[model samples]
Target chain A: MKSFVVARDLLREAASRRWFLALGLGITLMLVVMGLSLRMDVVDGALAATRLFGKSMNTQIRAADVALRPAFVASSYLIFYGGLLFGVVACADFGPSLLAPGRIEHLLSLPVRRFELVVGTFLGVLALALLGALYGAGGLVLIFGVKTGVFSGRLIVSALLASVTFSAIYGAMLTVAIAARSAALSAASGGALVLLGIVAGERERIAEFFDSGISRTIFRGLTLFLPRVSSLARSAGEIAGSEPVDPAALTSMLLGLVVFGLAALSLGIHLFERKDF
Target chain B: MRRVAWLVAFAALLGLSAFLMSRGDKPKKPERVLKAEFPRHPRDWEEERNRKRRTLPPAAPRPGEDEGIQRKRDPLLVALPVEKGKSSVVFEVAALKESPIGQIWLDCMLEEQAENKRRGRGRDDFKERFGIDLLQDVERIAMSSSKVAVLSVAQGAGRFDKSGWPKRTFGEKGAIWEDTEGRSVFATWGDELVLAGVDVKEIEAAIARLESKSPPQAPPIPDWSAYGDIYGVLSPEELADMLPEEQGEIAARIRAAIDRVDLHVDTSEDVAIVADVNGSNMDDVTDLAKSMGAALSLARAGAEDQGDDRLRELLDYATIKPRDGRFTVDVALPLEVLKQMGPCRKRDAAPSSSQ
Candidate 1:
């Protein structure tokens, strides 16, 4: 209950920021552009054609539901990929601001557990990202649904997956923030982790490029514990693209990513627990 | 309300994933039907079809047509002799002709012919001039480096006239009709088979191998039915020879690491090409795959930097992966890019009875 209160406060604090408002306005502006620009020509309940930005689409032709797949695909990719990128930027300051001299003193004076403060801030940023993904991706689903009368729930699935994926990256960002206490450094670390995680997902394939030697061993060792960002993103994309998902692969990848995120957060909490401030 | 909002948002996300999982297990509905309209302006329709083909997965079948009916289970590939130790290239023509892409190519050809007829430029009857209707008579065709053999239906049999035909006599074998203009010598195997090529001795050797029990050294016909419309096995050297002059060095390096290459091509929906390059050494296969990946990345980056969207799109679909003792390079071709190549139009313009 105390964690929830702290989380609520963190969110309330974030809402008052000018950057948060700008982010909301940016999302609204993009959706408005999409809604205004997208036009489809329906023939006999089938999507015969579409036009984007007054330029007619020449290739795509399919059933109404299937026709809206491109929209979902675009949104899912953005949410999973673009959301992580944006989360790094948007939540970079949340950590440092919480650890600011006055704020840390006040929080430590309270009966709140240090771990609870960490957990609260983590949840708050996660919630913020989830809401942002939903607003951006969900709005796309609704826009296409209203425009074409073909609604897909896959966009929602993508947004959810995006949020789930973000938790892992955000955990690492929080760890970096605790260690460095610099917003720029935290954001850079988060961005680097995202890239490393993506590479780690294809580590086995990448390792094949090196001859069996110390170089190959180093490559394998470096990526052994990293989250499989690309693999998870692929699963989400498949779900959104309406392609069949390999249940075992999807489940295992999701489990691995969640565990990685938890480990990163636990390590951050351990480090924060020993801090002088 | 604030506390409830967070819980509700989390629950909604979990619920959405559940919804996706549930729907995924359900079988998809059959594809929607479409009618085939005979193209009036063949050129324009060809352009339109080519433009639309980039969307992927091959053209959808016409209404009331079962695509499976066209599949041939026991293809004549069993008759192709794969010589060991020597370089060769093989093709599964019948399977290719039955593919969706094959049907589209045939229809385009027929349309082009029909247009020619409207202009009064060619022979009135294909069967009368060529002695066989390509669509109805020919069943399969296979080619090696030196020889070509065709398996045909009975209608195409004995159609080659021997009377007054210029027969070129070789040392021991009797005179065979020499099509000097076509640069081919034609020999019929009873009624349903024909062999033709520049090297008469190689043609005879191919026929001898076919007549004998399947050679112990013969290369296996790759099972590519699940992967693509056309499948083949070729020596690395043969594969390298097919590459453009600019990539000769890469091709040579690739050939050094591999003994045989299995190729599968699907043009039915989207243009996908998969090449499985087998090498004896695992390390060599891994190295080869890396080089190929690097080459492809360089090509993609170059395309992007140069603002060549088509090349970049093509490169974006290329994947190289190494497994066990072999590596595979898969490339997906964009139809719009292929249309720009003018290959189909060039073939349509070739001399034919209709023209």
Candidate 2:
């Protein structure tokens, strides 16, 4: 009950921020453009793959199949719903104000304990993240219905989940912000990590060099803490109505994110509780 | 209107992806259904039908009309003597430059053929060389001097020798290759002897023909007492049926026998048979002695290198070094300098190699 009030306060504070609105609007516009581009590319790929290898493709399944496909999910919501935002300038405001204002102390002065403050802020960020997730997910649902005449709850939810996963990455960044002595450092660290994740995900050639056993072990460990960030998008793809996502990858990533999320949250609470305001 | 256009484009792409995703496996192809617009070309269609019939001796339907891969287990055996023929073992002794053995094989083959003065081999010596082939260096730079690992994916090159061709991952990433037309190329790369290709079919055919095992040709027919000793033994009837050239090689053997390479083989008399793994066909050892008119070391892809124990032994026997965390093997020969002193000089080993 104590946590709920903090959550509500955190949510209200974030909702009142113009920066949050700007972030929300920016993300939606990007999704709108991205969704358009992906729709074309995924279709082009599908046609080419089908045509070249068409003789091998049984056309009989065309009319029978009616769910969101993996290819479409991959194309439409690459980074949108996984709760990850590429434009992170919103958090750029975390330069000095966060620490300079001694907001943690002010919050502690309130009825809230140190842990409550962290929890409340996290909840607030999450609320914002969910809104972002909805924007992205809703777009995907509209696209899927418009494209395939298939209204699927699974795909919309999957897109939502993917958006949420992205949000976790941002959430982790926000935690870094909370710990920083200066908001600039926190924002920088957050932006850099996000950029690193995006770059690492895309860079296959560089990844190939580190594709040794040790690297795989590290990758598995990372997935544990950032389960939502890592597996959310994948789950969205899998759970999208009509087709089931690949169970192995989804399960593994889910396991990874859960372990990591719980650990990071626990660590955050401990740090916030122990820190000097 | 612009919004509608964007929507339509998105919709089109979405529709296309869904359509592509829904295609079931095994869609109909249009090749096998023959619609012959044959107006007065009855003969051609008749010929085509006849050809198809001949190819399908047992009445199997053509591919489009048939389902999935043909699972016919071919019991084709190639473990015996083929037709009687004289195999001129073209010598490509390019031990120096560690010349990629394939290039030396080709060079020696061309040299031997040049001596015979013939042209128009399977690959054109004329129609624009596959230009300063970077791949040519693949053997010398990639395999020579240090122990290098090759990774080729295409491997079905050497003759199947009637039985299916064996697979060797001589570090190449793909299947080994053997160009037909009976020409194996051996070239010099700095000092590494390397091979790029050899007439795998010609040599396999040659080996198959060896089943005629006439009166044993050379005195020291590599001691078959141990591993792979006389795989093909000719009975007395087989001896009598031997080709005349086999008889001559047999006659040459009787006069003076070459000793086992390990058993103090008289280097004074016979061309030294160095089991040098410095040939292009290192990956495809089936074409060993065939490149040289005189069968030197009967080549096989690390044929002698077998089990883990043997591989370990090779690592032991050869000078071991490391490159990119892999062993680079070099089995040096003291007798190699002797190769330079005589008429048996390999082209790459020769003071003046044919450019």
Model 1 CAPRI quality: incorrect
What candidate 2 gets wrong by more than 4 Å, as runs, is A26-71, A74-76, A79-83, A87-102, A143-148, A195-235, A238-244, B1-355
Candidates' chain B TM-scores in the order shown: 0.62, 0.18
Report how far residue B244 has shifted in candidate 1, in Å: 50
Per-residue lDDT of B1-355 in model 1, one digit per residue for the tens? 5434433443443344333332332222433222212111224543453244222122233567566542222223433455653333334355556655555555566656877778764334545543655556665555555355545445344355633457553323223566657566666554565566676665555445434432223334532322234456677776788778988877887678888877766665556777778888888876666666656766665776899987876766666555677777767665555654443655645666367
Q: Interface Cα RMSD for candidate 2?
A: 23.9
lDDT of 2 by residue, B1-355 (tens): 5324433443443344223222211111322221111111124543453243222112233546443533221001111122232111111112222332334334555465554434543232221232222322221111211111111111222222332234332221222323343244322111222233354443333222222223223211122211110011122223324435644553343222211111111122221122211212221221211222112111111223444333332222222122221212223222333333333455556556543
Give the 10-residue window scoring lowest on summed lDDT in candidate 1 chain A: A58-67
Scored by Cα lDDT, where does model 2 land? Answer: 0.36
Off by over 4 Å in 1: A58-60, B1-355
lDDT of each: 0.65, 0.36
TM-scores, all models, native as reference: 0.50, 0.35
Error of 1 at B178 (Å): 33
